[model samples]
Structure formats: structure tokens, C-alpha cells
Target: MKKAKTISLNVGIALALFAVFLVPAASATTVSIGSTIVGEGETGVVSLMVNDVTDLGGVHVNLTYDASVVNVTALTNSDFDSKPNLYKRGHGWVLLEGGQYESGLSGSVKLCDVTLEAVGKAGESSYLNLTDIDIETFTYPPTDIPIDEVINGTFTIKPVTPSAKVVINEFEQNPPGDDSGNEWIELYNNDSTSVNIGGWKLINSGGKVVTIPDDTVIAVHGYWVANWTNGSLEDSNEYITLYNATGTEIDNTLTAADGNNDERCWARYPNGIDTDSDNDWKYQTSTMGETNGVPVAPVDTTPPTTNVTAPPTLWPGKPDETTIPSGTPLPWTSEPVQLWFFRTDNSDSGTGVAYTNLSLASESVADLVNVTISNNTWTWETNLSKGKNTTVPGTVGEYFNVTISEECNATIEYYSVDKNETPRVEPKKNLTVRIRFEIPFSEVTPGTRYTANVTHDLIEPANEGKDATIVFFAETATIDSKPYYVLDINKSVGGTEMYVGINETAENFTMKRLVMKNKTGKIMDLTFNPEYTMLNYPLWVGKTWTSTINVSGTVTYANNTTIPINIITTEIEAKVTGEENLTTPYGELRCLVVETNAGILDTGLSKPITITAKYWISADEKAMIPKYQSYINGNLTEELVLK
Candidate 1:
């Protein structure tokens, strides 16, 4: 699939709502120090939870203890949401193991009565088995990485047996981009002693060997995980096999087996990321442990919350005004809202306030852009508020003040970027400038005609009553209308030369003619400059040339405005040679690629030099072919636009 377009608009929005505050909290001791001693069989469940009532989003708890003496049995549901509650029922476990575990194993255990247990007697130099804890927790050894605080869940553990020890954590698949190709696996150290997975091996279903870094280790009270990077070999829909240092297969996740998006996991910890076996590999929700035909259900009993605050305020700026140009529609609107009306200057003795003050109602504005935008009418009600009878001011300097307000919340709706306006420049007069072709597109080969639209302030010039003549000139001179020119020249079927059909206008009062030249001198052409004559000279119009020609002359009008008009001439080199290749757009034809080092052309890779024989078909099918185009990096820079 193609990547979504990332359009970056560098517009800054001043937020006036939600604010974030971080307050220093007094340190609280989680575990009663010196109360714990070392040894095994000293079964004890120590659970600590943080409950900030005012913050329903939940809070965090910091527990410190002697790892040598106490074993962390489990943690129940450790993810956070908007609710505040503690659960005694957990669905998973993490045990001390030699390697990672498969997430899809189904010998299930219930989680309602899950609890942390230390099974040894006191005063004995016993070890604490950190059981059923989150495999990716930073509280474990080498705790430098920051944990994602946005997640909340619980943890728990059980006594170590001689049987297999497996801890599993699953990551859900996100699609399109970073969502896909991202995965995780959790491993728990359910024993008192921290286990090192330095020489562990990770393999896939295809029996292919995989490499894992030797520095990886799972702390006594924590878990370990595997996150695939950009270059890792991962099955789009296959299983992953995990092995120990001795090349013994410890765990394997079956992909593509139970259909698409199925469970490829086995769990020791309950209430993990996903609960559905095929969709998410969460531990069984009922029984938690297997103890000599007896089922021991363990649960996590900790709760956490988050605190949030409101944002800052914004102050409105003073308004300004300006005169509406004549013929322009009065009472202009400022974008999505706020109608603008011109008023006489009541301030500074009729000099008028530089702008109008229309204190728009907050209901009439918006802070973000939305799809329901139209002309600046705030609402149907306020739109009717306009068109009211204008009062005839009794005084000369008195202003209309155009009362402006909104019937709806405008400021929160129609939010706009506030760019300070600069002072306007007055109009100039009696100046005539004749623009000629500095360069033509044909001179650049793989280029085309330059078309541009122009708009003028008709009211400003009309108010000044300045009678002026505006003309558009090509290579040829013309009368009142814009001048025209023939850019393409080719041999016609009638044995005559061809010319462009469009005409352009000129700017001078005198008339003249242009001459053409070529080194071969086989045919005469046009020159850039024509012999200039006064306005009284005989003016020639409607004349045609049969051979090579150049267009250059002077023009006149009733306004008497004048300027010199010149002919523009240039040469281009297109050395097309070679048989054309077949394409979907253009069929087979001859073409050639000519390399150039003249200017900013790319010389890195071979560039295309496509050419085609274009036939204008009157009835039969036309033969069309590809043309040359200039590209930079992988983007089109210029191309020949055939008319």
C-alpha cells in the first residue's frame, strides 16, 4: 500500500484549555524495611497499591525491597484507564526460567485467588522468588529505560516447581505503518536469583536460525522481551520458535496456523495485552497454579491513577479599519466569520481609525479548522443581523460603527492566523513598461509554454481616472488587442511554412518590421529588432509571409501611450536518434538520450531522451510517442507539454 501523504502546515495554535501540571510529591515507603529476611519456603504475598482519589486516571507506586530475601509472586491487571478499582483476580504468571516461553500454550489456570507467596521459614538464609511480574518492567536490574506510564495492569507469582517454567506476554498487531511489523515477547524470572539469557537463540517456523544479542538478561523480579527492528526477518503470517543457549527449543509461537490473526502464544502471566486466545495470548481467567493436584489461583491487588489540569487564557487584540475601494462589494468578511464594514474616522478629527472595530462574539469564532465552512456568515440569525438600515450620521466625523456580534460561539469555532498587516502603498501613474520575452520555453527543450493569470485593482485605478493602455506582447506586434507570435515552424503538406495561430499586442506608437537570419541563409527569418518609424509613418497590418519570418514592430492606440516592442529569438538543440521503445501510453517509435553537462542537469544516472512521431489524424488513428522530460532525484522537474 502507498504511504499516506504527510502534509506539514507550520501553523501554531494557542491552546486555551487543558494544562499539564507536575507537582513534587513526598516520597512514600512501599515496603517496611528490615522486616524481610532471606530464604526459600518463606511464602508471603506483599502487595502495594497507590490510590489518588482526586485523580480517577490513576497513579503509580514505587516499591523497594531486598531482592535477596523476598520473592515477587505476581502483579494483577497493570494497565490504566479512567476508572479506579483493585482486582483480586488475575489471569497469568511469570516464573524463573532458562529461556523465553511460547504464548499459545493452553494448559490453563484460573486467576481469582492469585496471591504472592514466599514458602520458606523466617531466620533461614532463604532466597525470594520474584514470580509472575511484568517481563518488561524497569524496576528490574539495569533499570534505566523509561516504562510506558500510559499502560496499567497487575502482576502475581507462584512457588517454583521442578516442572517447566514459562512466562508469556503478547503484543497486538497494528497495521499500515509502525502499527505492523511491531511485536513483543515477555519472559519472567520467577526465581530469587536473576537469570541471564546471554546466549539464547530465537528461531522461526521455517526452521531458519535467528540471532539474539548476548547482553540480554531477565532480572529476578522482572521480564524480558523481543522487539523486531526494521531489518529483522519476520514472518508476515508465520510462527516464531524460541530456543535456549543449548539449542533446546523452549517456546514457539505458531503463526498462519489457526487462520489469520490467531494466537501463537503460551502464558505464565495472566491478564496480558490480549484476552482472546487467537487474537491475544492472555492467561486463563480461572485457575492460576498447579500444586500437587491442587489449583492455586493468584490475583494482583494494586491500583494506580493520573492527574490532569486546564490550559492558559488568551487576550484579544485591538481592531483596525480601512476604506473599501469603490466598486468593490462593501462590508467584507474576515474569513469564516466576522463581517467587516467601513466607517468614517471618528478618532483624530476625521482622519479615521486605521481599521474598524468589530468585537466579534466568542460564539462566532472557532479555534480549529473544520469541514462546515462557507462565506464568513456566523449563522443564519447573525447573517440577518446585517443589512439593517444605516443611520445617517448628524456629524461629519461620526462613523457607522457597524455593530458586529455573533449568535453562536465564534472564537471557539472560526479560529484564524493573526498576521500583522503592513501599511498599504499608494498607486503610481503615467509609467509605461513594455515587457518582452527574456527567454522562451522552446530554448529549454523539455519545457513548455508559460501561462499566468493577472488581476488588477480596478477600483483604485478607476478612482484616479488614469486613462492607460495595457497590452500583452508575444514576439509579434499588434493593434489594440494583445500581440501574437508563431513559435513552432514546420514544413506543411501544401509546401509552405507553418506559423502559430495565437496573436499578442504591443506598446509603442510607431510601426516597423523585423528581419530573419540563419548561418545557412537557405531561408530568411526574423530579427529581434525592427527599423523604428514615427507614429505618422505608414502602418502595415494583415500581412502574411510564406517563408522563414521574424516579427517585430511598433503599435499605436487612442490613448497615445507608447513603448518600444522587440522580437524575441532563440535556438534549441534536439538531436533525436534511435528506435522508440514500446510503452502503455506511446507505442513503438524512434528516440535518443543526449547527455548534457551544461547546467544543473543530473548526470548521476542515465536520463531519458524520449521522442515520438505525432500524427494529427483526420479520420484514422494517430501515432503518438513519448517525449523527453527532465527529472531530479525521483521527481519530475520539467517536461514537454505538447499543445
Candidate 2:
């Protein structure tokens, strides 16, 4: 199955309510966060549930929560919604809404999930009152009229229970990502009934503590979770301790997990069972706020034998090229072309292949490139004599966000990325997938596209130049106070192309080594740029910002001899000019127009002489990204509209 979209702290909520197509008749759809019963000083997630929702295209959820009482931290899609999150919070009200250009979700969907911090006074009452709700449909002829329904959630805040019997159930100091936002801890309530836990504190090994907020409650024998970057545990030899309102100890001396768990988190099996020993806690795939899920150990102990290769480009290439140097950037072709790629995975792990998926990026297609995605996995079943394929018509948009299995094929059509997902595989077995597709040239100015990224699942070294999750350019987000973006940097090695990944873990894009080709068509490692800034967010009208960038990387020709990377300093400046009512496949929206003049930055060496772009930003606060973009560099580069 395709991996779910990941949201980093850098890119806020604008992308949260992403592009999930919904189709249903709105028989008055009421939306609300389930009874808001949070405890003061506690951090938890609230759900935006829909009751009696049919053929739901999109929803605009606006609600007010006493800012003094609770603060929203992040948003996640409920079982019913699948798209990058599309919601915003400001002025005490959150505006949550999203729809797909070609699809819709059906009845009784958990529209979205809200992660918030309860920061109210004990016994202070606050309401997560649904102020106004608008459910719109974009079926052929658009429906400007909104759907109405009974709100599904209730709002109620309670004070802390001084004698509550909540204990630290399971915790993970580190899980994954830039190594910061992955830690979490679960609390189990052994009491007879739900207990309010506001104004409590969870202390770390360093003695630092964060207070629990109001509205947090644990039902009889239920569980609650504190999982966010701000509330993360230390990924070291630290300990976790829980304290009540009066500083009474609840749970303590719990060891923290190390900093490298991916897909796995520390959990307790045999619910509520504690031995005060490491054996009491086992590391397994995280279950978050639910019962201790099926225990499975981390699979990183042995790296899978992976080889991802792309056909030669410049001219379109075939799918069977085995040598690495066969693929090279055409750098000048702009017309449409067919792309074919292959991947093979072999492992010694017992769960040979539980499941796997692929995600493609928007950059992989032209402005209006149209194509079909067929599922060939079922055909292989017959080759293995398993019978036949799913036989369903293929669709790109439908498969855009899910994993393809025996019963389902690729439904992706629009969106960026075809990331890979994994499944439990048998030991010493290899499973391979070879996919090929046709993409029209990135039709733009100069009548041809200059730079092309051969689409793949990931952009890292071990996998050659493939990127399952293109972090660098996935989406734009707001971090501390500034906005940032992740970009995949491509390099040529052995006359072939290779890719590298960059993440701002150290608060900047930390590039340490450069992998390139030497003259003998061999890969060479060299020193590269360190932490640096690539882009910014929070751009407002009449606001101009400048950033100095150092362009540095080694250059190698067909000859084995290579020159050390050159370091050049360049200045970049950008400004927002006006607003635009941008139109997309979803609908029309008001956007911002930001003009930039940085020619050098375009080449990663010098500033651009004349760079103009209309970043059609929405009038909405969380619409930080341009819904429609028209950019002009030395040549007409890109013109795109969000679907």
C-alpha cells in the first residue's frame, strides 16, 4: 500500500487538509470535535468527525477554542480523509476544509484529527464550539450552496483529578524523521472511570517538565498519548516521570528509548502490565493512542539489498538497462517522453514483504500531462499461477494515496510522489517491481524543459538517485518563525545520475559528502556544502527578504580527474506584490503574488538577473503555498496550478 503523506513541522497545516476527492450527497453534514474533555496541561488529539455525510466534496470547519485553554499544534487525517491536510488556525478560530479535484469521501468519516495542548486553569470551563460549518460539493457544476448536518462532537473541559490512577504505559524517546518530532508516550488509566488530568506534569531526565492542559481525559481502562516535537522525550539514557497537580508522583523511573527507531516505538504488551524492568517494555511498531498493537521488532538491523535504476535519458531510454551510467540528464529536452524504471528488494528478515508502495511527485508530470495507471501485480499472480489481475480499470488519481495489492492496483493520477512502502517479507527472498510510464515533456517556456528529475521512490545515496519521499521539495512549511523547504539535489556519477537528500535537522540543510562520477565512470565521494538556507516562508505583501547562499560542489567529467568543488556567494531577494483569485482543479481561491529577482540562485552558483513569479497565495492564513504559480526566469521555466 502507498505510504500515508507525512507532514513536517516546517510545512504547517495548509497541506494538512490535502487533496482527497469526496463524492456523496450532503444530507446535512454536521462536523465537530468529539466531546472536548481535556485535562489542563495535557497534550492530546481531538477528532473532527462527520455524521450522516454523503458524497462529501469539501468542508469548511470553523470553530473557536479558548486560546487560554487549548492551543492546536498539528492536524492529521482521520480514516475517512486522505490528502495533505488543508486547515488553518488564527484569531481563535480554525478553518478546516479540503476536497479532491476528482474524488470525494463518503458517509460517517472522521474528517480530520487535531493535536492540541491543554493550557487552561483547573476547573475552568471552555467550549470547542463549532461556530460555522460549510460543506460544499464540486460535482460537475459546482455547488456554491453548503451542506448542513448535526455536529458530531461536544465540548467540555474538566479540571485535574488529584488522585487519578494514570500510569506511564509506553514511551519512545526517538522514532524517526529529522530525529526531533518522533518521540511519544502513552498513559494508561487503571481507574474505574474517566479521570480529568489537567495541570499535571511529565518530567524528563533533565528535570524539564511541561504541564498538561485541560480537556484531557482517560476513559475506564483507556489510554491517552503525548506525542509531538514540543512534547518529545529525550533520545538518550534518560527517564520519564509523571506528576500530578500537587506534585504527587504518579509514574517514574521509566527509561527512554534510543534515537533511531523507525516504524517502531516502545510499547507494553499485556495491557497495563508493568514490571519496572526493560522486559516490561518492548520496542515495536507504534500504536499511538490505542491498545498495545501487535509487537514487531525494528527491521533496520540488516539493510535490505536494494538496487534502483533508471533508463538512459537525454533521449528516452529502455527499461532493462543494467549498468548505472546508462541514465544521464538530457538537460535540454522539453517535449513529452516516456520514463521507465526498475526496483529490486531482497531481505533476510522473516517478514519478507508484508507490503510496499510508491509515491510520485508533481514535478514528474507536465502541467497537463494525462495518463493511465494500471496494476500489473495481479498479472504476476498468473505467472506464479495465482490466477489473474484485479481486472479493474486503472486510474492515476484514485491510486494516488494508497498501496497497490492483490485486490487493488495503482489509482494515482495526480499529486507528487510515488513513494515505496514495505511489507513483511520472507527471509532470503527477493521481490522486484518494474514500472514504466509515459510523461509529456514539462511543457514550459523555451518550448522545452531544461532540468528533469527521473522519478523514483526516494532520493538518497544507498538507493542510487531514487527518492521514495522527496523531502527537499515535498512542500513548503513554517518552522520556528521562518518558512523552509526541502529539495532533492541530483548529481552525475560515472556518466550516470545519482541523488542525495537534505534535511534541516541542525536547523539547516546539512550536506556533508558529495557523491559523483569520476572520469573512469566510477562513483567518487567529495566534500560538499554544509548547513544552508534554500527558501523561506511567512512571506507577506510588501515584505522583502534577502538570503546569501554559498554554491559549492565538485564537478567531474568523463575523465577520472576531478576538480574540487567551487564555493561562490550569491544574494537572493524576493517581494510580494499583490493578491490573485487563483483557480485550480479544486476551485477558485484568492492568492498572493510574490516577485523574486535572483538569477544566480537558479543555477545554484549566482543570483538570477531577472526572476519573476506570481505565487497566487490564498487570502487564508494557512494558505502559505501558492495555489497557482507562473514563473519566468531566463527562460519560461514552470507554470503550474494545484489540483
Candidate 3:
């Protein structure tokens, strides 16, 4: 049986050895934990002591504190050092330096809180221990407390501009901008409240005043009223003066009416005190309204739009006569000019129309413009740049957006259309059309199947104030086809020559003769010279050598005997045996003796005879397969036979 260890709560704590004074009524005792404050680069001292304990035997105690929960800074003096050894123990902490103890006396341990000169790593917490180590019956509080939450406060701010002014002067225009037929005024909201500028009037030197409605509220700490009339008259260069609801002059531009300089100001009441000024905006060296005497930005102000009608200069018919105002300018060019072609047709199926206005190199057409067609469910714009080569997702029959943009002129034209089938451009008739290409493949591989689909549509564009075009889909005629394989080999030995059968086959079930070439640059058989069939031939697979030979050149056999084969029609591979640069040919090249019923040298044999000889290979064949012979068109072209 294991004996329980005794815990050291208080050195003098003992279980009533003499029964002092009637055992003072067994009352509950409580313990409390506290922390000490340490300055920057300073140390903190802590103590753990126990009192009023009746018994302290048969208890094992340990204290643990997480150092990370508390900040431990470098001490100013070397004397102040925090070695975890002094207090930290196995999952707990212990008090160090127990001085002389007195019977029934209070016991205390000292600890030093480190001073932090600089901020330590963020998102960390340190802890202290006040827990009971071995006494399970004596409950103790936890020591791990969040230290990161006990940090200091911080402050931050946004940026501001210089030359932005705050003043009170007369104004010719609400916002000061270009005076040449264009006018604008800027206001900065320096406060943190949304200010109401309703009933505020923009007064001019000529006594003309424009009222700002109640909706004229500027956002807090931002610019507002970039231009007068909610910025509509921004382009109109007119002198402006500002007035409050009481018709009093609160702010105005200088007499010069140059619409420049720091002569602009904003006031609370008409002529009331200015709460904030461009020259006094807080938290910045410069102002928020101006940057180097130039306007930084227009206020986030929204102005009403006005429609102005202008007469057309020239027209096809009605020359010197007035026509309807529905037609837009002719030759729309890069702008999003409305296009409408109407023809009285009672037919249910609309006319087929095809028109090419831009090429693949053109910019996006539907960027800023929208087209709508009446009685049509789709709109379309074709502005695909070959450089982008964008691909649309979904099947060819799905609905998609077609956009065209003209970079030369800042304009974008777009439409939406559903293309379920191909669209045709027919004879003379009014029809709406939309086209977008939907390629099924992201990229084209050599022998991979891919479909390039062109979606088409026709619709009306004048009914719904939007561009609408129907869509139809069609795909290319041919998909992907396999590559053709041909094996050409030629070889000559001394004066005798033998030609391997040539074979060329296509994946489309077409077959032809495989061509032959030699070292002497001769099309047929010539002098036997090596080095013509190097890497150009496929001889090695992976790092290993497969039996593949090319009959392009001549091969010298033993006894001065040689055979020239034009093409070796054999399914063999040239593979690398070892790192010694030796190529070994392996596989069956000829029919079995029983299958042929004649001999391996049968002249009319479909399978070629397998020959092995080093000198019988082409010169280029050695360099081609670094470790093996040549394997071309999935067939053996050359083989080296051992003498």
C-alpha cells in the first residue's frame, strides 16, 4: 500500500495537538488570489500563504501558472530575473525562499512580475497558480487567466488633404470648377453627424438662388455637394453663393469668381459659426477637401438628370423636313447608340438575320450599353477578343450574356439571349440577332475531341426599352481526329541490299506505304552510312529500352554479308537496358513458323523478320535513343544482331 504524501500549506499548521480553547466552532475559511501592478521594464512580487489550518498532513500540493498569460518584459536591473525554475514545476508552481517559520505563524512566498519595455507577441495570455496540488478534498481556484485582455488603449485615423480651405465668401457657382460652361462646388463634412442641407439655397451675385431640398444630407466625415443642383449643373460654369434656410449668406466664393483657391467654407446656420474648417480638420496635417490646391474628390452627391432634345443635322429622307425623334445618330460607331429596324410582318416566325459588325480583336461591346428587343426573349452582343479566348459554361442550349466593347471609343454593348439552335441571316427583312460562341473545351490538345459552338438568335429591340435577341446554337462540322503513323527505314550492306516492308496507316482506316531514307540523302537505298537516324526515332520507353528498329540505313552482318531493308513493319520497341548506353530490341517481329507454314524469310510475309546487329543500325539511331535502338511509328525500324 502507498502512503499519502503530506502537503506543506502552512509550516506551523497542525491538527490541534493540545486542543486550544474549545476548538473554535469549525467555521468555513475562504482564500483569495490577487495580482500586482508592474511598470514598464519592472518586476512584480507575489506571495502565497495559508492561515487558520487545523490539519495539513497526508496531502500532496502543487501550484501551476501559465507564463504566457502574463507579460514578461526585460528587467531594467540584472538583479530582477524570472527563472521558471524558481516558481514553475511540473504542471504547477511553488513558492521559493521560505524564511524562518514560527509556530502558528503566517507563511509567505515572494514572486517578481516582469516589466515589459516593448510590446511582446500579440494574442497570448499568461497565468499564475493558486491551485491545490495534492489535496483533492481541499478545493483550490484555477490560475490561468486571460493576460492579452489586460492591455492598454490605442487610437487611429484616416488620411486628409492639403489646400482644402474653410472660409466665408461670395460664390458665383455652388462648386468651384472650370468656368468655361462647366461649374461645380465641393462641400466637406468634417463632423461625425449626417448634416441636413435641406432648404439651403445657393445664392449668386445676381440675386438668383437655388434651393437644396431636405434630401440634401451629407454623410458624416465625408465630402458632399460636389456640384450644385445635385451635381447636374456641375459642367455649367456659373458663380455661386451659399445661403442657409433663413436666407442668410453662410458661405460664398470671392468677388473674382475664379472658382479657385481656399475661399470656400461651410457653416451650420446662415452666417453662423463654422464648426469645422478645411484648415482645421483633426488628425491630419492637411485638409480633406484639397490636395496641393487641386480638388481631391467630388462629394458623394447625387444630382437629378435632365433630358435635352437636339435636332438632327442630316437624314436619309426628310431633308429640310422634320422626322420622328425616335431614330438615333447614324453610324453608331463605338457609342451605345440605339439600333431599331422595324418591318410590318405578320408571320409568327421572325426573319433570320446575320450581321458582322466587329471582329475577334474588337473590345467588349456590351460594357456600358444594353439592348432590348420586343417579342424576343434574349439579347446578345459579340465582343470576343482572340487574346482572351474566354469560354462560357453550360450546354450550347443555355442562356448567356453577349457583350461587345470598343476600346478606341469608350463604349460597351451587351445583350442576353438563349441559343438552342443555329441562327441564319436571311434575305431582306427586319430581324433582331444575337450571337455568342460557346466552346466546350478550355484548351485544345493534339488528339482531344473539342466542340466550338456558335449560338444565334433573332428578336425585336424597340418594345421594352431594352435590347433583346433570340439565341440559336450550332457546332462545328468536325471534332478531333487521331494522328497518322508511318514508319520509314532504309539500310544497305556492302553491295547487297534488302528493303523492309513500309506501312502507313491512319486512324480513319486508311493505309499507305511508309517512305524510306538513307545517309547519302538518297530517297531509295544508297551507301550504308550511320548517324542519320538518331533521336528522330523512338527507341526508348521511359528509362528502359524496348526492341524497335528502323530500316532507314544499311546494316553490316558477320561474314561481310549485308541486307538492305527499306521498311521494317514490325511491332517492336528499342529500350535502354542499363546505364551503359546499350539499346536492346525486344518483341516479336515475325509470324510463328507454324502460322507462316513456310519460313521466317517468307517474301510475302505481313510480319517482318527480327534482325539484331550493332553495325546494321543507322548512324542517327545511336544518338536518337541514348540507350537503345530506334522505334518509330510504334514499329521497329532498326535492330543490331550480335556477331
Highest lDDT model number: 2
Rank list by TM-score: 2, 3, 1
In order, the Cα lDDT scores of the candidates are 0.28, 0.47, 0.29
Please write out the lDDT profile of model 1 over residues 1-643, one tens digit for every residue.
1232222221211122222224445432121101232235544333333222111221222122223333345544322322212321111112221111222111111111213444334443321212112212122232221222222222222333433333334332222234334444445454466766778766555555545678776665456666544333343565566677887876555363221233333343333222324544432322222211123332212111111111111102322433222222222221223322223222222221222111222332332222221123221111211111111111112222222232232222111111112322112111111111111111111222322111111112221222222112224545334343333221111010112222123321222222211222212222222322111101111111111122333322224333233443222122212223333233443232322111111232133212111111111012221232333233442232222
Top model by TM-score, which number? Answer: 2
Off by over 4 Å in 2: 1-28, 79-87, 144-148, 152-157, 161-643
Per-residue lDDT value at 236 in model 3 = 31
Q: Compared to the true structure, candidate 3 yields what TM-score?
A: 0.18
Better of 2 and 3 by TM-score: 2
> What TM-score would each prediction reach against the true structure?
0.18, 0.22, 0.18
Query: Least lDDT summed over 10 consecutive residues: which range in candidate 2?
Result: 380-389
Task: Kindly give the stretch of ten consecutive residues in candidate 1 with the minimal lDDT sum.
Answer: 306-315
Candidates 1 and 3 compared: the better one by lDDT is 3
TM-score result, candidate 1: 0.18
User: What is the per-residue lDDT of model 2 for residues 1-643, given as tens digits with 9 covering 90 to 100?
Assistant: 1233444542445444442224333366566576566676777777877666556676755555556666667778755343325244443445566665666667676767777777767776444655445565647664744445455443345655545478887776766675566566788997878888888888888777767887687799898887644555667677888998888987864465566757676677766666666677766777777787544554533322222333355234545444323222322322233233222234333222112222322322222223232233311111111111111111111221112222111122211111123432213221222222211111111111123232221112233333222122343434334443323233332222212233334221222332433334433333323323222334345656655555454443334445443565655566666656755443565555765554333243233334343445443432323332223344543333342
Rank order (by lDDT, best first) = 2, 3, 1
